[model samples]
Structures are given as C-alpha cells and as structure tokens.
Target: MERLKLDVLGLCETRWSGEGHFASGDKLVISSGSPDGGYGGVAVVLSAAVKNSLLSYTPVSNRLLVVRIQATHVPITIIQVYAPTSSCAAEEIDDFYEKLQAVIDAMKSRQVCVVMGDFNAKLGLGRDFESGVGDYGLGQRNERGDMLAEFCRINGLVVCNTAFQHNLRSRYTWISPDGHTRNQIDYVMISKSWFSSVLDSRARPAAECDTDHHLVTMKLRTKHFRRVRCKSMAVRPFDVTRLRNPDVSEKYSVATENRFSLLQDRYNEECTPDELWDQIQAGITEVAEEVVGRRVRKKPPKPWISEEVIALAERKRIARCTGKDQEYNDLKLEVRRRIRCDRRK
Candidate 1:
C-alpha cells in the first residue's frame, strides 16, 4: 500500500474464512467469503484516511463486498468482486451476475460507484463496442468477456482499463505461470455518466503481492465534501502542555480557582450532583480556553514512498519508452519483489 500510495485496494480470491473486518497495521481489510468453505472471497482494504470516512459496508456474498464512504461532497460506493472463472459452470456464472446486478440495483443513483476486482473475464480488445469498452483492451474477446461487456452496457458502466492507452504489456493484468499466456481479465469500471471524472486506469504489472494477478487501479478526479456538524458540538483540545512552565501552571491554577469560586455562588446549595459537575466542567473549560488555548489539529503524515522505489519506477518508465524489454522486465520484477517484501513487513 505504501509503495503504490493506494487509498483503497480491491482484492479477489481472498479465501478468508468468512465476512468480517480485520486490522493490518494502520489499514483495515473488509472481506466477504463463502460461509460453507474458503475457496472464494473478495475484499476491500482501506487506508486509515479513507477508513475514517467509511459510512458502512455490506458483505454481499463469497464473491462480493460493498463499501460506502462519506466523501466531502457526496457518498461513494465501492464494490469489490471475484467473478466465476471461465471453467466454472454456466449456472454458477449466471448466479454471480444476478447477485452483482441486484447489488447495483440497490445503489443510489447519485452516489459515485466504483466496481473493481478480478472478473476472470477476458474483455478482449474493445474495438467495435465504443460505448462500454475502449480500444486499448488486450487479447481477443471470449464468451466470459462478452458477458462482462454486456453487463457494462446494460448498467451504463464504462470499462476504465480499456479507455486509456498504455503499452500492450502494461494492459495485461494476468500472466500464465509458464509465462507463455497473458490476458486482461481483471478490471475497474465506473458509471458512464462520470466518465469525465475518470482520469486514468491501468494495470500495474510491477506490483508485488501474493496473488498471481497484477494490481489494477483507477484514478478519479472527484472531490470529497466535509462532514456537517453542529458548532456547539465542536470540541477542541486544550494545550495542557503549556502547563509545563511553572508560571503558566500557577496562572492556570489561579484562574481555574477563581472561576470555580464564582460558579459556586451561582449554583444553589440544593443543586444535584449532575448540575454541580456540569458547572465545574464549564468553569474549567472556560479557564483552559482563556489560559492554555486550544490545540490545532494537523493532517496525518502521508505514507512514505521511498526514493529507491521512485528511482526504480522512473527507470521502468524510461526502459519502456526506450524499448528496453529485457531491462524493463528485470526492473518490473524487482519493483514487484520489493513491494511484496514491504507489504509483508
């Protein structure tokens, strides 16, 4: 996650035992898997910043998971899926799409929706279908690919990966273990109406992970709105650290004592314990604000992306541009290996 600087990562074939959330360091992993077995699963891993805005999440099934987050301007719904493989039964494939469609149907029309994962459907070069697919797709269209394209067309979704132009090698998201076969089965899709908001989408072959599939990402140009709240409910931290100075501490103590004395005169002797406590709290807060002042909140530090990774990424770019296939492959593999090791740490 730190290597790629990803905010949210969709995972397929997670093979987790069941549907639930798990903590991995600072990030959170929300997954949905088969209740009867652990053969299939889907998950969405959220960065701390993004997780803070999470409104809710739903475990659709072993093959799907939906997450809703409260953005600054609107709510965004993200759906992670693990579709049936080509070898799977037709009935099972149909069932998977049916469940997926149902989830889409339930979504609010105004909310931004991002559906991404390993579809296991090779959406070959999207040549003829200009509306739902782009011309940059890899390989020839298969039956499963047809189903995926049709699904997108029906739902007014656009295939993000095909829309962008990248190197043929960069377009393929999966490779055979023998290194003889490659295909673009995994994808990221968004509502057709918001196509302009989609900056780019591509496959990161150099991404290191345990899975055989490469990481696919989509960048959107949308902005988040700040959460609304009552002003009276706003709470600021007092700069108690100022009390480290003897002079400041003495002054604060004197001010608090004076305020408490005044509050005691205002409250009746018959006041309940709760009322007295409230008065005391108010007095202390007033003195603290006037004496110590409130502490300012700072944005959390961004995840570190090291210079080594940056240099390697730049080298990869240059190698691609210069048509250094062997060098590019070597660097890509190194980058992926480093990423895998970093993530494990």
Candidate 2:
C-alpha cells in the first residue's frame, strides 16, 4: 500500500483461519476467514492514513466482508467479496448474492458505498451491459456477469472501472497462469450517487505481485473534512479529582459559589437561554481552573521502573560515558534494587 500510495486495498481468497484483525508495520489488515472452507476468505488492508477513519467492520462470511470508514464529510461503506466460482454449487452462489444484497440494503442510501474484489464474473461488454455498466467494459457477459449486473441495477451501483476508458493491458485485471487467457473479472463498483466523484478506476497490469490478478486501483475525488483541532481538547480539564481532599473540596465549593453569585446579576438581564448557559459553564470552568487547577496528566509508570529508578539509570549512563565504571555499576545495582522495592510496594 505504501509503494502504491493506496489508502485502502481489498483482498479475495485470503485463506485466513478465522475473523480477526492485525497490524502489519504501518498497515492494518481486517480479515474474514472461512472456518470450514480453508481456501475462501476476504480481507481489507488500510493504510495508516485511513486507519484512523475506520468506524467498524463486519465479517458476513468467508466470502463477504464489510468495512465502514468515517471519511470527512461523507462516510464510506466498503463491501469486499470473493464470489463463488462456477465450480461451486448454484445454491452457494445464490446464498453469496443474497447475503451481499442484504448488506448493501442495510446501508444508508446517501453514503458512498463501494463493492470491490474478485467477483469471478466476466461482465463482458455487450447488450447485457446497459443499465449500470458503462460503455468502456471489456469481454462478453457471462451468466455470473448477468447476476452481478442485475445485482448492481437493484442496488443502484455503477461499475466504476467500466466508466473510464483504459487500454487492454489496463482494462483486464486477471491473466491465466498459462499466459493464454486474460479477463476483467475483478471490479470496483460504487453507488450511482457518488459515481461522478470517482476520478479513475483501472487495472495496473505492470505492477509486480505474487498473484495473477493485477492490482485494481480507484482514485476518489473526496476531500475529507480534517479537523485540525477539537473544541473539547482546547479546554484542559480541571483536576476535579482533587476534590477528594477535604480542604480542597471546601475551597472549590467557595470558589464556585462566588463565581455563580457574580453571574446572578447577568442572568437578571435580557440574556438569552444560550447566553445564560454559557455564563454558567464559563463560571464553573473558571472557578475550577482557579481553585482546583488544570489537570496535569502524568506519564504512566514504566514497567519495573519508577522516577527514582529512571534518575539512577540516567546517572549511570552519564557515569559510564565519563568512564566511571565503579559509579555506573553502583547505579545499576541501585536501579535494580529500586525496581524490586517498587514492585513489592
């Protein structure tokens, strides 16, 4: 993902053991695995930039997975699927589409919805590709392709890759291992409401990967509303915990009482309810800050080490650098002893 500069990537047939998520260096992988069918699984890879936007993920089966991202202005729901091949029973394919349609139906209609991954359906271009398929599609429509096309029409989604014109190399996403057959079975479909926001969608056949399927990338023209600062973060919380002290509690009560008494005169004026509420909130916060003090967040104690041990270690470092072996050894012993004492306490 870092090399490709992709914010999100979908994987089909991941062959994972069970549903779980794990972090790999800078990327986060959310996998949905098949307990019974070891070969069938799906996953979504999120870059560090997109990880923070992740709202939730639901593993509908080994074949289907849904990931929701809270993107700036518009949230996004991505459904990744590894559709059953023709070799599978017809009932299984029907079940896959039924589960997929239910997931799409559950989503809000206005949000940006993207269904991507290996459909194993060659939605070939022709008379069958009209309602949702764009003019730049490749190949001839197969039975599975018909099912997918009808699914899109019902869900109001557009084949994003077909909406743009790309060369044959960039159009076909999969090539047979024998280097004989090439097809466009993988796709990126987006809701019709935000279809125009899709800047580009095509395959990168030249990209190197272990699989025969080329990487399918889609560029979206979405400027997520990034919040530089949060309103609550600006106001440092008062050390209300200090109220546990009897003297401190008395002081805080007196200070708050005085502040509220001063606000009484303003409340008598033609102040709106909003203004009154602001005055009350400001008075409490100000009194708390003045008497209780802003809460000082202390660093969590390091395992087996306290402030004393840390100071001892720093001295040992300086002594070692100054070639004081004896002092360094003494400090080292002291640090160990201090850690033991802290643990006992």
Candidate 3:
C-alpha cells in the first residue's frame, strides 16, 4: 500500500469470512464476504487521507460492495465487484447482474459512480457498441464479454480501460502462469456522464504484488468536496495548561467572569441550559484564542520503508531493465520474501 501510493484500493476475491473493518497500520480495510465459509469476498482499503472524506459504505453481497465518498462537486460512489466466472451457471451469472443493477439503481442521481473489479469477463476489441466501448480493447469478445458490454449499454457506462489507447503489455490485466494467454478481464468503469473526468486507465504489470492479476488503475480529473455539515467552523480547543501559571490563571478567571456577567445581563433567566453552555463554551474559546492562540497540529509521519528493501527493489528494477532475467527473478523472489517477513513483524 505504501509503495503504490493509492488513496483507495478495491480488492476482489478477498476470501475472508464474515464482514467487518480491520486496520493495517494507518490504512483501514472494510470487507464483506460469505457467512457459510471463505469463498468470495470484496473489500475497499482506504488511506488515512481519503478515509476522512468517507461518507458511508454498504456491503451488497460477498461479490459486491459500495463506498460513497464526499467529493468536491458531487458525491462519488465506488462499487467493487467480483463477478462469477463464465464457467458458472447462466442462472448464477444472471443473478449477479440483477443484484449489480439494483445497486447501481439505488445510487443517487447526481452522484458520480465508478464500478470496478474483476468482472471475469473479457471485453474484446470491437466497435459494434461505440458508445459503450472504445476500439482499444484487447482479444476477441466472448459470451461473458457480451453480457458485460450489454450491462454497460443499459446503465450508460463506459469501460475506462478501453477508452484510452495503450500497448498490449499495459492493456491486459490478467496473465496465465503458462504466459501464453493474456486477457483484459478486470476493468474500471465510470458513468457516461462523467466519462470526460477519466484522464487515463491502464494495467501496471510491473507492480510486484504476488497476484496474477495486474493492478489496474484509472486517473480521474476530479477533487473531493467537503460536505455541507463538515464546512461549519470548528471551535478551537482551549489551552488549559496555561491556567497553571498564576498570572495566566488570574487573567483567564477575570475574562470568564466578565463574559459570564455580560451573558447574564443579556439573557437573564430566559436563557436555556443549552444556550448558557454554548455562550460559556464560546467565551472560553475566544479567551484561549486571544491569549495562547490556536493549537497547530503536526502532520502524521509517513509509513516506514526499510533501506534494505528499497535497495533490493531498485536492483530488481535494474535487472529487469537490463534483460538479466535470472537475476531479476531471483531479486523479485527476495523482495517478495522480505516484504512478507516485514509484514509478519
């Protein structure tokens, strides 16, 4: 996560039982899965920065989940899904689409929706549905791919990956172990209304996660807006520690008394408990701000990355670039092993 610099990451086939929030260092992970046993699961891992703007999260099913984040101009709804494979029964595939459509329909009309994850559908290169797909897609269309394309057409969504042109290496998101097969099964899709907001989308095959699927990401030219209620002025905390000084204590006491006297003269007995508390709180905050000034918060420290791992990663990259395949493979294994060891600790 630290290496990727991702603000929000959608994970498919998490295979974790039950549903709940878990903490990994400073990151927060919210996942939903099957109750019967580990099988299919979906999750969204948020960085501390994006976590603050999170509005709500819903676990639609073991295969799907939605997270709403308050953005600048509009709310952004992200739907993460792990669709059933093509080998699955037709009925099961139909059920998945039904539930997915319901989730999309439930979203607010004004919200910008992004649906992404492992669709297990290979949307091939075709211009038959020009409005739903671009000419840059990979491979040939199959039954599942047709269904996915149809779903996009009905919902007025554009497959972001296909919308942008890229080389073959950057187009395919999944690769078979035999290295003979490559397909663009995973995707990131956004509502047609905000299609222009997507700057680019591609697969990062060189990313050294142990998964066979490459990390697919879409860059959006948008910003998150602060919510209305969140825009209200926050009362600065009083510096109570200053009260320990005799001179400061006397001054604060005098200020409090003067403010209270003015409040009493203005409201008398008609002021409710709530009103009185508010006035007092405001008075203290004012006095503190005037006397000691508002507190300055320090930025949180970045996640630590060891120098040894950094050096190993650099060497691995160099080896790959120099065509030292054997050395690159060895260093890649070492990097993964070290990462696992560090994560365990």
Best by TM-score: 3
Locate the minimum summed-lDDT window of 10 residues in model 1. 298-307
Tens digits of per-residue lDDT for model 3 on 1-345? 567667889999889888878666577789989996478999999887777678888988899898999888888999999999877899999999999999998877888999999999988986655448887889998889989989998889999988888898889999798768999999999998898888898888777455679989898988765445533456555567777899988887788788888877888787899988898889877877776666565455444556798789888877865878799889989988888887676
Query: With candidate 2 superimposed using the best TM-score fit, by how many Å does residue 177's alpha carbon deviate from the native?
Result: 1.8
lDDT string for model 2 (1-345, tens) is: 655689999999989888979876567889999786569999999877887678789999999999988876778999999999889999999999999999988988778999999999988874334457887778888899889998988888889888788788788888896768999899999988888889999998645443679889999988543334578877778887899999999998988888888888657657888989998998887787778898887653334446677667668767755778688678877877887898797
Residue 146, model 3: lDDT of 86
Predictions in order: lDDT: 0.83, 0.83, 0.84
Q: How far out, in Å, is residue 110 in model 3?
A: 1.9
Whole-model lDDT for model 1 versus the true structure?
0.83
**Residue pairs with clashing backbones, model 1:** 72-224, 72-225, 73-224, 73-225
If both were scored by TM-score, which would come out higher, candidate 1 or candidate 3? 3
- Per-model TM-score on C-alpha atoms: 0.68, 0.66, 0.73
Candidate 3 clashing pairs? Answer: 71-224, 71-225, 72-224, 72-225
Residue 163 in model 3: lDDT: 80
Better of 2 and 3 by lDDT: 3
